[model samples]
Target chain A: MKREIPLFLTAVIGAIVLAGFFVPHPYVSVPADYLQRCAVIVVAFGYALGGANLVQVNLEGILRRHPDWPYKLVLLAGMGVTLVFGLFVDRAKFQDPGTVSLWIYDHVYVPMNSTMFALLALFIASAAFRAFRVRSAEAALLAVSALVVMIGRVPLGDAVMAGVFDHPGLPEWMRHLRLEPLQQWIMDWPQNAAKRAILIGAAMGVMATGLRVILGIERSYLGGSD
Target chain B: MTISTDFGVWIAALLTLCVFSFLYKDNPLYKFAEHLFVGVSAGYYIALNYWTVVDQYLVIPLRAAFDGSQAGGPFQAQMQDYRGWLIVPAVLGVLLFTRLFTRLSWMSRWSLAVVMGVFAGLKTTGFAQGDLVAQVQASLVPLWIPGDLWGSLNAILFTVGLVTSLLFFFYSREHKGVLGGVSRVGVWFLMISFGAGYGYTVMSRISLLIGRFQFLLVDWLHVR
Candidate 1:
């Protein structure tokens, strides 16, 4: 009964929402809109549930004096402080610029997030240098293309092209062969075509997966052994 | 060379350095910063959603429905009218907490089922109309432009590349002869595209690094 009820609900709800797109009547559309809003509310609860889980797990870790308990303490402290400030002091305008919550976000959160992504710059450079060796025809083509695009998209490459093209005796053909123009051409034709192809295939895959889920053929999300 | 007087800028710089310290080695500073980031962000999101979704949508409406106050907003009016129906979702949301209890965990499946079903339905039509139909329409390019050889060549190349790439993904038959050659060409196009993508990604990451450097130098240190 448990399994059957959930599956039936999934099929029925899925069908009704999908039908809402085609059926513009107030009866269908209004309910569909309400369902979507309800989904958002449920999702918000899910996030709060996740936050609760984090606190629970970390508090347990700290109490048990597990390895790296100090970090857990820090995490719990940060969450507690932010939650207090946000829920009480700045509840009405927590998002306002001068609020304590906003202050923490702008200073601590923004820097941490940006720095984390910025680290990718150094890692990518090191990784590309190590991995971009030309071992075969395909690898060679890839390396050359990457190198060309990398250089062509940057100002240094444009400066070099400008210097060469603006020489006193430079030909018209040489002027037309600038890095930026070549990069644009490559992006416009070959890159765009490949991207479109991938997008189309991905869209097909999404449709198939959505159908499977709606039909309850994909029940992995239901959790438990099954 | 003079540091700024702003304490917040100093805090930001120190935290940025703490995160960047991971590049040198895993240390307590990085660990502290990482944990703090996750916890604070979670709290922020929880607060944001409480105000935006729970308090605004659910709590306020339920309150208005109970008090019979017409002073509340538009959503409150709707909820007051359908207050009975609104109880269903509130119950479903409360059921999600049943996951914490072992025996009652199965009840949470109803909530998950509704969420997944609604999302799957929305996404199916969204992808079909927006991505599938739209993309296919875009691929129908006029290959024979009257005056522009460059445009015509580009069109032809684009069409050929798109077809070959699609064929490459087609695993129905054995790619042994003509299909093999075409698929190989498709792979070349894909590789080139991926390379460009990687290059673009690298450029953006570098730009982010530059932004951080600018923050440190200009904002914190008052460097020109």
Candidate 2:
């Protein structure tokens, strides 16, 4: 009953929503709209369930004196404090600049998030130096293209290009050899064509997978092998 | 140079430094900041949805349905009508919590099934209309243009590139002779595009680093 009922529900609900697109009648549209709202509400609950799970896992870690027990305690305390402020405090006032919840978000969360990403800058620079070596034809092409694009996108590259073009006795055609224009040409033609092809392929794949799920041919999301 | 006087800014600056310290070496300070970030974000989202989804959409509608009272704000007019149909979703949302209990875990599947089903159906039509049809239409470009040599050349190149790239993915027949040569051209196009993507990504990461430096130098420490 458990497995069969859910599978049946999936097929029925999927068909109704799919029919609404083609039928466009109030009978189909209204039920589809209602089902969508239900889906949103259920998804929200799932997120809350995830938050609860986080608390449970960390609390267990703290209780067991795990390797990072101190950090777990800190995590739980942070969650507990934030939850209390968010729940008990007036909802309308919770978002005010002076509120504790807002303070934590702006001062703590924002900085931490930005700094984490900022660290990636250093890592990427080091990685690119090692990875962008030009040993073969494909590698040379990739490296040269990357170098041009990188230089062309930045103000420094524009300045360098302008300086070169300003040299005395330079040919008229050499004056037109600007990095930005070349970058634009590369992006607009070959890059755009390749991206479109990839998009079309991906769209086909999505439609196929969606059909499979709706028809019950794909049941991995149902959580067990059937 | 002057440091920020605001107590909150100081706390923020310290936390930012604590996270950045991981670049040098992982330590207790970095670990604390990481854990705290996760905890706070989870808690914030929980509160956000509790008010936005549950209270605003589910509870208010149910209350107005029972009492026939006008709920203020954007939903006021809808509240006046009082939808009895909303009860179904409310019940299903509650069923989602059943997963926490082992005995009732299977019941939660019903809620997940509905969500997945509706999304699958919607996505099928969405991809078909928006992506598949639109892209195919876009790919049907003119191969030749009158009185514009460069334009015609570009058009032909675009057409050739698109066809060859698509052929590269077709696995029904072995790629050899003319097919192999065309596929080789497709590989070069793909490589160039990927290289551009990688460059763009690096630029963005660097911009993020510049933003942090500006914050630290301009906002936290007064520097000209």
Candidate 3:
């Protein structure tokens, strides 16, 4: 009875949600809209679940006195501090630019994210040196394009080449024909195609998962016993 | 000689040096930067969620709705109507937290199911119109261009690439003869596309590193 009822509701609701796209009637549209609102609330709940899970695991680790326990302690501290400030801390006193929260985000958070991303430049340079060999026709084409882009971007490429070749020469033509056309081709075709595929897959996945949840085929998420 | 200019230059130089260190090998300095990243990101997301909920949902709307508190407030009446709806979501959000208590965890599914249904409906419409239909339509372009031979060539090549790629993605069909040949070509195209994407990502990373270097050298230090 427990499973059947949920599954029946799932088939009914899921079908209606799917049909709502085609149907313009208030019956479908109105319920669908309410369902949408309900989804947002549910997703918000999901986030809470995720947050609580993080806290629970870390807290448990700390309590057990496990290795790297101090880091877990720090994680708990950060989570607790943030939550307390969010829920209980007086909002009025920190009204301006110099609030503790704002200051932490700007200086601590932003810089830290920036620095990690910055570290990837090293990996790129290494990858370029090792992987950019012209082994085939396609590889040769890619290598030439990469060289053109790099030369066009940097001043050293122009200065060094201008001395050997024609002045104001290779970089300008490279920029006009190769770099521009390649970039345009990438943006117009491949990117759009990939994005479309992802959208389709994601939409289908959402429908399947929604049906699973509605019909009670996905009772595991609800803690299973019921 | 000056403090601000000197500081900028020093910081920029340090960042540049740190980035350059990657050329040699990974070290503690890299790990330090990485850990700081993890810590700060976790902190930032929590702060961001608070800001979004408090400002958009609770604070601004509540003030506008209930408080007849602002003069020249045309939105006051509408806000009041909207305020009532907030309770539904608020209650659901609270119920979501019920997962923390094992006893009441079952109630969380009600909220979850509603959300899944709505999101599914939204996705169905958006994907059909924007992705499935639109992508197919885009591929069905006029092959011949009036003036430019190159334009016509590009159009033909694009159509070929698009169709082959789609066929490659279809896993249900057995790859025995013609389909195999088409899919093999599609595989090559997909690889090249991914290589291009990787190249772009590398450039983005480099640009970010350069920015940090610039900040460390120009903003934090006195050196020119």
Residue A106, candidate 1: Cα error in Å is 0.5
TM-score for candidate 3, residues paired by index: 0.73
Please say which candidate is ahead in DockQ: 2 or 3.
2
Highest lDDT scorer: 1
Residue-by-residue lDDT tens digits, candidate 1, B1-224? 89999999999999999998999999999999999999888888889888998787777766766665554533442412544355667888888888877798899899988898888889999999999999999999999999998899999999988999888999998887999999998888888888888888888888899999999999999999
Q: Which predicted model would earn the best TM-score?
A: 1
User: What are the interface RMSDs of all the models?
Assistant: 1.8, 2.2, 4.7
DockQ per candidate:
0.66, 0.60, 0.29
Model 2 lDDT per residue over B73-125, tens place? 32332312326667777778788888777788788889989998899888989
Ranking by TM-score: 1, 2, 3
lDDT (0 to 1) per candidate: 0.85, 0.81, 0.58
Number of clashes found in candidate 3: 19
Worst 10 residues of 3 chain B by lDDT: B74-83
Ranking by lDDT: 1, 2, 3
